[model samples]
Target: MERTGGETLLSLTIMSEYSETSSTETFSTFTGLGATSGKLIKRVGTVVVNGVDAILIRRRLNQLEATLGVWSYSTTDSEYVKSLYNDLLELSRPVYKPPIRLRALRLIMGRIEMMRFEDLATAVANWPISYSYGLLKTMILCFRDTLPLIDMSVGIERTEALVAYHYTGSHRAQKPEHCAAFLSWLGLTTSLSTPVFSRVLLQLDILSFVTEIYPTDDHLLRPSAIRFPRQRLLNALLIGLEPVNDAVLINQVHRIRTIFVWARFLNPPI
Candidate 1:
């Protein structure tokens, strides 16, 4: 989540465009332009998806309309819009290296109170497992606040929050494969009926893999896109390993051999 200190200037500037004109009315409402005005919006053009541009310029334009608008600086709408813009701005940075449309999708979600992620959901279905991993990570983080609503009780908030941290990172070599695979692995094999923790425990295998490979400097652990990001991978390991037993860690590493094998994460990407 974005801690405060977001870019207030730009947010203020954008909102000022729709600010009041020193009028006597305490509030001002702009009826918005005609549908033809859609032509005036700028396209975000060609967000990288799997080394190929996702060609989402059109949808990007639509998002700009819904999320960004002129508003008076001191009005109720303006403050809310400003806050939404700041969050969208946070999601826009390339530090995460996510696909542009994916980021925009999150930004749009951050602004709206209730919505479904239909557009990105469709785009990710055909994506490679690696790309899907990235998209999933962003969704989890953007919606991390909503975990309580989904839970029958709020007791496992910490545990649910941890799953959202699993899928995002810089390199395939360094990325953690904790979300989809872990969820699937537990769903199929577990007979315990309630495997919420199992959902998280399945990821311990990957947790152990990184611990083994990062220290050994081995070439057998490279995933094509799995190059590591310092903050992301480090923190993920820190969280995942907090509950680990040294002996259990050894067995866990052995369990996720297939993920590492398929990822071929050991080979360095040239």
Candidate 2:
């Protein structure tokens, strides 16, 4: 029988609490005692049905599990891993509805949550709309908390807080901007264009953004266009603003001129 999302999570939770130290456990302990320590990991199979896609998902999950095994887990780390697993399980739900959405929100809002950024990114790509809907809804909930609920106001402050609270970074160098890139990718997937998304997109490397969001089209955003601030042109790309359009070409020309003008003023007659 195909395992339900809830079943998958329950099984993982039980496995994590396994007390009997078997041969595999001994091997894990030995591996941890080595020069390089390890993180707790559970073997998870693909939920997708397509054979080729399932193979890809399995391979990716293995890669993530391998990488996760390199990190040492404390009580807090273990909790974070559990939260991530649960979050993904919720995101993996095949039939997204109000009940699932509420469950996802309750988990997110009930506590400060954490997850592997890469895993979250992978889920954003691989999960079904129902899952994505829940994930995005949870994000929106977090975003709500950051703003003053007095007038029902939400802004970048709320956005930053949400990003910080959820995405604690998979590595040292992971920053708000990288989190933004992940969101930008998610936004592209879910058609969620907002001020927060734009802010995040602006902070991402142009090539990285294009490659992840518009992989097949390397030439979507021109070098000249990218030299301008990301916000100035991000909407154009997201909105499918045709480069061949006379108005867009004219705007690009004007933007390039403005950049040159600013450069000249900043370093006049060096």
Candidate 3:
């Protein structure tokens, strides 16, 4: 979806004429011939109305009227003024509604909170691909503070969850940095013991997947080649392995390093 920072509500140049016929006035009330007296307060200024500006301007005008007892009226030739009432009605109508994805995630998270470990795994496996990353991220963050308190049996479920989470990154619309950040958070928070770590790496086949997706020399050579950031993913992988002190895990880390070296050799420096 296309996103914008802000919207313009209205824009116009306003002209005002004030009557200065009050007896309290100390100065000349009329410059031109009139029954009482009048003063022209013509302001040639463009006012771009946005959020809260309309309300602020109205308040300022009201304050001026109350304090100085000066009665004034303004006119704008802009066609927008013709439908100002309708425009205000439109603005008054509610426009904020949560995205479908967010609502779905909230429901899923609620379901997950009451589920057994096996059921959680099943849910993760069956989760719609579009929102899998969101669900996984939410799960990780929810349990982050109480990782140590979690039962060991939940490790298997977490491993399955991670595997499912990894595949979510393959979605075309998925942001690489988001996936990378998720992995980094997982590594930093949860202590991925040998069995769980090994299962996640092997089940996901992360090494092979990374090799397949990493932009190769030929791809880089093409002028039209679309390169997305992979450095963050690589770093995330290394960080995820930081808690593993096993000799086998160390060898796996070295292999990952070798792949990095090969990738650097194939692709030219930016």
The most accurate candidate by TM-score is 2
What are the runs in model 3 whose C-alpha is more than 4 Å off?
1-202, 217-245
List pairs with backbone clashes in candidate 3: none
Worst 10 residues of 1 by lDDT: 36-45
lDDT score, candidate 2: 0.36
lDDT of each: 0.33, 0.36, 0.34
Tens digits of per-residue lDDT for model 2, 17-110: 3332221345432232211112222222323223322332333334324434333333345444543444334423433333332333333322
Pick the winner on TM-score between candidates 2 and 3. 2
Candidate scoring better on TM-score of 1 and 2: 2
Number of backbone collisions per candidate: 20, 1, 0
- Model 3 Cα lDDT, one tens digit per residue, 74-171: 43433322222212112211131122222222323332232212222333333333333433433453323234434475543443343333333322
Of 1 and 3, the candidate ahead on TM-score is 3
Question: All candidates: CA RMSD in angstroms?
Answer: 17.9, 13.6, 23.0
Query: With candidate 2 superimposed using the best TM-score fit, by how many Å does residue 43's alpha carbon deviate from the native?
Result: 10
Q: Which residues of candidate 1, in runs, are more than 4 Å off? A: 1-113, 143-270
Q: What is the Cα-based lDDT of residue 20 in candidate 3?
A: 31
Q: Write the per-residue lDDT of candidate 1 for residues 131-218, one digit (tens) a residue.
A: 3343344333432333454555533333332332322321132323332222222222222222222224334333443444333333
